[model samples]
Target: MKRIFIILSLILVSAAAVSLNSCKARDKNVIRIGLNAPITGDIPKVGEGAKFAAQLWLEDIKKAGGIEVGGKKYPVELIIEDNETKAESAVKASTKLITQDDVMIIIGPFASKQAVPAGGVANNYKTPMVAPWSTNPDTTKNRPYVFRACFLDPFQGPVVANFIKDEFKFKKAAVLFDVASDYPKGLAEFFKLAWEKNNGPGSVVAYESFTTNDKDFSSQLTKIIKSGAQILFVPQYYNEVALIVKQAKELGWKGTIAGSDSWGSAETVKLCGSDCFGKFFSTHYAAAGAKGDTKEFIERYNKKYGYVPDDVSALTWDSLNITKKAIESTGGLTGDIKKDRTAVRDALAKIKKFKGITGEMTYTDSGDPQKCAVIVKINNKGEFEFYKSVCP
Candidate 1:
């Protein structure tokens, strides 16, 4: 009887110890990552690319046995929510990420207009958000917790406009922009201002606007063709830009065409086909001629995803890496997140020269990166060729 009692007591103690160990394991081994993107909407490709890159980063981190934080290594767990390419959906997604999931940091919703509303949520919750490719200057302005890895439209717009003026020497230009897209509208305005400022008066001959869902651009193309402009600037995304270029060609309006970083995608070639040849655009980075860390990223991404990554994907990876580095610098989970976030924000702001897959980055007080833009011109082979790099 004494022996049986002793065995029972030992078994009870063992079970209690096992339960405690399980609780500890759960608490110490998990870190949540949140992604708010338009996974099922008109701009699904952009969102899909951002989510894919974030997942790739998480996989790589886990493969290396997770990140060490607060004396414990924790594997990353991603929580992705679709924003449906709407501003209201973005706000809802961000609120869920902060309130329910309790994510330490959040990635993006891909579009500038979406970023504007979503960023407000991050600011309200005091959570850090690293945007992948939202380029509107207003996206990060006055939002303490919001940051981006891509060049803003203000910077990119002037750069491309100047390129058209100086390199192509196109004196008179026409502009066709999407009124619904903050990116295209903002960039179009900047480009027009810069063109007029550089070329003196009457530099902009035709300025036209189209809605996002508009398919036929023959009317706008006809006006641009009759304007006697040497160059045409289409500040819009790949889908609309491709359509416009194709329609312009169909209208027999042949001139130097220019675009913004939104043109940096393989779909541009697929959509415009031969019409995109000889067109030039300013972008953040390109996979071709990539070396060092960029080369490694390309190789790993291709091996993992079975295709080449675009500039948005590359920037998404860089945003994660930047966040990881910032968190690591704060000594993992040891410091208070609010305090650590400030430190991380400061660290990011003070980054003078850091090589990223997107290019060299150095953030200013406004949280904008001082970096070079890559100029790409489409060749007759329907592939983008490196033209030159413009430093600001």
Candidate 2:
């Protein structure tokens, strides 16, 4: 009889253990956020910063006991994919995240060329996406599921043009753009129109183009130099920017070189060496003298990592927080992932005033962030110094 009782108690204990595990599993739920980055191609730093920033954001969320939705707290899970800095690769990565991984939100492929194609694939599944660095206007066009954290090329281009024309009095400007890249090409086009309109017609001294694989910029820089341009604007990536600066300096071109946010990487200085000093670029934020949330983020990132966070890092951090806010605004994820996803999309669209580490952003109805741009100068120390802020 005692043996029979012992067997029954053992059976009860086993059943109770299984029940406890089931309850714990329900309590320790998770929501996956997909990150598509160009972690292997020409501009790997962009992706590296983004991935690091997401990890930092996740750490904070975990400390806070995860993101609360519908009164249930869920630990945020990040699933990162390498896009290889190409549009086709971005499409493949984003498709996998949407279909196979079943992530609710996806953050970035850095540039517009990749973001546009990735955003298209995300649109089909009604998945929410926030591109931290993409500036091309076409990225969010007619796509409600897609959003960006940076100012559009049109918005930022005029800021750079007006700053040079109004503040620096640089009337004669020239442009060197990558013909194959959408961000640089669109920024160049916008800058040209704004320069001519704000400064004067024919103010742009020369317009030059290059491809992404082109290493020899001497041919293009020679034309820009011969045009007697006081300000040479090269709205290209940091890799190409470094080459352009090195080649231009080697050619004895003494003009003030300016560029877009793509020039915000530390690789610019490391690649161009001493030639990159004192140049200027328009970006989302300047970390060296940042204040408020920006200051706090830079300090924390530096403490955890070995270096300071750049524009892309801050944007990626903000995008992750923005996604978290959207998830929470939906009252937590519902059992129906489809309905909850739509709710998250709707919540994101309604975010008009979002104060982030970068700056205060007001999202327009079209999914663009209505924010200002900051011009940063590379000091003699190869550090980004906050020069000035331009608001629209």
Candidate 3:
């Protein structure tokens, strides 16, 4: 009787262990993707766009019965954490996503200010992160795990410089940027280098700056106009873009204004109104005259969201799809988070060419994509029209 009792206890213990292991295995059957966006801060519109686009992508994944890997389908979930558009906030958000959420991959913190800091956390944690619209080179510089969906400022700077020189025939240029911010500051320097190389040394007549959240630009505009600048290049977000452009015009500065991808937001023209009409800016894609898949995305987003999608939205969509491709290309998940994340990162690095709705991207060693930049003209209707394409 004693022997039989002992045997029954051992059998029950073995059954319990098996049940526990089975539960653990079942827990690993779902893939979690993290999103760290500025959902409630300075650029809430950017955050809104990222969230909306991600949800749209998630819908597609669900429709296909989740993402398939190695002939097995794993249900996917998105863990969204708002970064609030601050550098420190981004770091904390990314850390939580990696350590607590245990996400396979992270996407967003769109602006360079947030993306740069968040990237460090992701890289240190050995998690893959993709920034949808961060154009600063430092966002991916020396960080193998960090990647961006947009062109770097090094490429964008020269593109803007050459465009202004060739199209407008402008020899003297003025630049107004936010010194406190990384994106504008870096692009300002690069543009200056490119402009001086194309024209002559000291060709940039005026280089003025302001800290973030400064509404008045009369002081900078005054200096720029006094410097005999024929064009004013403002590489700032939509909020600052409208203020700078309007304040410049109000101050009796009559030179053409040009912008960078930051101006591609729908709020730019809306805030600046007729003041922003007939301006040109360098961006990822133009929504006014899109075709094929690009047009389809824009139409669907507009119908569902009640507004035209911006470059950030398009890039986020592309980034998620790229993430999906990389995850699917991992052959199979080992039910180990670390191993699977490494596999996804490796697959992403090996992806040389990907056709995105924005453009075709060829990944480089540093994980930056070789893609073309589009010059968009803000027409009379405040619509972003495709003007020209510049390639690297």
Candidate 4:
């Protein structure tokens, strides 16, 4: 009888121990947000800027006693994983964040290449995600759980095409895009459709494609030059744009150069130097003519990071605020992860009038953001000068 009593007591003690440990395992006052970023790769600067900007937001929220949810507040804990600038790497990082870290939501993986795979993982697990700087539509097209902070390429491509036509009064445009990559290809298609539809069919003088990692654009440039294009639109990354501009100059085809946000980078100036003068790209915001929230953002960012904020930093900063606002609206998690994710998705769908520092935005049913695109010229000082602000 004594042995039975002892066993009962042991069982009760073990049960109590298990309950206590399980309670201690969860804080109940912390919300985990996964940050999937390319922190260690070719364009680490973008990830560095994004991380720095997010840290600033984190500090602000911490000091404010965390983000409010259902009339209460929960401190957010960020689980950052490096995507390493590869789609396969992003898939692994995103899976780890969702399955291992059990993060409630995710932010980042800046480019579409990273966002596409990371978004795939997020959808596979029913995790809500927001991409900051990725403009490709495929990132969020069919995925209701995925959204974006910036305008889509469909919106931006038209903005650039119209801006070039209206402001410069030039109609003959040429597209030289990286055929292997989706961002440039998608933008080129959008630009072509808009340019032709608005200005007339066949306004585009030339349409050329080049594979990725192709250093020589002479053949493509030769085609564009021979086609009599007044403005050369190369919707490619800054590195590739720099090379194309250099090669174009070497080929002695001196015409106006225009591109999309992928061309907006300090490194573009560093690489192209005076060769990029008078060239412009459609982007989020520029430092020299910023105002209101954008001005304050640039000032604060410059103070913290010792440099001006780029679109990646600006959009990442806004992505956090947008997510926090959605969580607040949805009251964030009733302990049912699946239902809570759905709630977050519904909240995101209804997110309108979000006054982000990037701009006031409204998320459409298609998960596309309605936002303005700012055109900035690379001045001789190698700084982005505000040229125009185009609104939808």
Clash numbers, per candidate: 0, 3, 0, 0
Count of clashing pairs, candidate 2: 3
Winning model by TM-score: 3
The collision pairs in model 3 are none
- What's the true lDDT of residue 102 in model 1? 65
- Alpha carbon lDDT of residue 368, candidate 4? 72
Model 2 misplacement above 4 A:
1-28
Report the CA-based lDDT of candidate 1 relative to the real structure.
0.82
Better of 3 and 4 by lDDT: 3
Who is ahead in lDDT, 1 or 2?
2
Clash number for candidate 3: 0
Arranged by lDDT, best first: 3, 2, 4, 1
lDDT of each: 0.82, 0.88, 0.92, 0.86
Using lDDT as the measure, the top candidate is: 3
lDDT of 2 by residue, 1-392 (tens): 99999999999999999998676442225788899998989789888999899999989998998888888888778899999999999999999887777788899978898999999988888988999999999999999999999999998889899988777888899999999989999999999999999878998989999888999989888989999999999998888888889999988899899998999987888888778899998999998888888899999999998899878999999898888888888876665566767888888888878999888887766678888899999999999999999999
TM for every model, in the order presented, reads 0.89, 0.91, 0.94, 0.91
* Model 3 spans with C-alpha error above 4 angstroms: 1-26
- TM-score of model number 3: 0.94
Taking all chains together, the TM-score of candidate 4 against the true structure is: 0.91
